[model samples]
Target: MDLFFTIVAAFTIFWFTWTYLKSKGKPPSPPGPRGLPLVGSLPFLRPDLHSYFAELASTYGPVVKLQLGSKLGILVTSPSAARQVLKDQDTVFANRDVPMTAKVLTGGRDIAWNPYGPEWRMLRKVCVIKMLSNATLDKAYALRRREVRETVGYLYNKAGSPVNVGEQMFLTILNVVTNMLWGGTVEGEARASLGAEFRQVISETTELLGMPNISDFFPALAPLDLQGAVKRMKKPMDKLNAIIESIIEQRLKKEKESGSSSAVEFKDFVQFLLQLKDEEDSKTPLTMDHIKALLLDMVVGGTDTSSNSIEFTMAEIINKPELENPLVAIPTPRLMDPTLYK
Candidate 1:
């Protein structure tokens, strides 16, 4: 046991020394905490990263270098530095260091975490230019109306009842998103059940994305996934993938039954995407994996961000209202002055 302990200590010291000497020739990093070797600043990470990063910035200048295990985290705190990366020279820094859970969730095919290059450019063009064009988005107004009407009707039905606004808003957002993707929308109990699963999955997935994983920091140990982050992530991701597959299969079956395009016309985002997929002559061909990943992206991003923002806004309004208008209340239906969403 004494010999084993000595061997371990010697190996650790040797490895740390070797690593330090190897990096000595590289350009000097920005001023920041000189954390312990091997693990670096991982031990100093806080739950509230924004505040922690702010504190670090105050001490180590706007650009702080954090050696997080085997990875290096460069903090750009200043608006000008951020602008240089985000807008001025955006393309140069378009790629991201994807986390394990995020990679598992999107199979690294999503536009959010994909490396900047030809494939990413293609995804950008497909997702942004074509899908979100004025003509395509204008078609979704009816979808928006139908969804909002359903939500209003639901609120009307649930009068004098205690409501979980966050969950309800998330469900409505998910339904709207799914409806915009494909015309088949569930309601009532089905929506409730499905929305619960989505809430759990999205919540878990996002949390895992934010969590610092041992595998991510130590690439050599990624396959092992020492912290079980990767294993935990696969569960929700598999469920999400299954949901996407079911939707795709349903659409394909419907298309086959209805003769693919028997004068019905392609209406929804799914139809448009599938039509694009069938186009074999495109230089950067869109695959089934790409379609699935993009759909998952839409579901996760749309539901999570929109619902969270709305919920926060609602909470703030409730806390300090400009007017006494509660967001989740049943509307008074007067035909005279319709303030939209009628």
Candidate 2:
């Protein structure tokens, strides 16, 4: 019975799209590679989506239009088109397309994936004022400096040995973020468990989020479980949610014991959220789910991006050995032009 229903829905969607496209007067969007009917260009998408899009742009001019399943996607490769999207029509394109994996992993509460509306606005404001504002970031700078110093010490201890720079960089960034969010460092056995959990959550989330799942574009056939990708993602999402819930419960218990008026100095993200929860905001009550989602953003956005950039910088330096020579011969800042000093 479910199969029959899925087939009927798929056919209905196809027929509706056919009629809609026929009624449109605009020339069928810019030309690009042809794809299978119903599924469209999804099959062609690669793990490295940026490179795939770049290749298509080279073949079909700067702007290439393609249909991913039933959804229309326009890839702009030209600098002018990028500027237009970023500056001229920024608000129009501000909202993101959240994939199924992201929705499940974040429990549909992350600000990055939230649709543009009141909730998004409220969350964005909270993030700016409580989390990423200059003052909050400045307060965390000492934590960052301490983490970097420890990392340098570790490298010094491993001198003359071939170091796994990737592992070291990941630990350095993770320690910094953990300190900034939890008001303490994860060390000994706790550090190992935290590192393992963090890496598993981050790695799985990125892989699932980036994968081309047909159900996202062809929503009518979602229940069919055609690709089985949705089923595959369930375990990791559950694990991530469990980790987040445990952290939240621990923080809440600690807050309760400390009492509401206690003047405990907090230099972490979780403490900041707990403080916000105490405020009288009837309009936007900070629910458990909201706290979990914010933590997800802090872990995913805060740690992964910075660590990746650090890896990239290391890789670039390795590729050009000359760049490393200046570190030994002269101070790092002296390499920069004095005229461009900010």
Per-candidate local distance difference test = 0.83, 0.76
Candidate 1 structure quality by residue, lDDT tens digits, 229-326: 98898998888888889888888888899886434665677777787888755788898888888888888889988888988987888787753455
Model 1 stretches with alpha carbons more than 4 Å out = 1-16, 156-160, 319-342
Per-candidate TM vs. native? 0.87, 0.82
How far residue 295's Cα lies from its native spot in candidate 1, in Å, is 0.4
For model 1, the run of ten residues with the poorest summed lDDT:
333-342
Checking candidate 2 for backbone clashes, the offending pairs are none
The ten-residue window of minimal lDDT in model 2 covers: 333-342
Q: Write the per-residue lDDT of candidate 2 for residues 1-342, one digit (tens) a residue.
A: 999999988987997798578749967678788776667788888878899998999899998988888788888999999999888988788787777777767756779888777777878888888777899788888878777776777676677999867666777788877666776688777776777677767877777777777778987877876777677778877787787777767877887887752467753677777767778375867766787888778877777777778889989888999998885687656324333222
How much does each candidate deviate from the true structure in C-alpha RMSD? 3.6, 6.2
Which candidate comes out best when scored by TM-score?
1
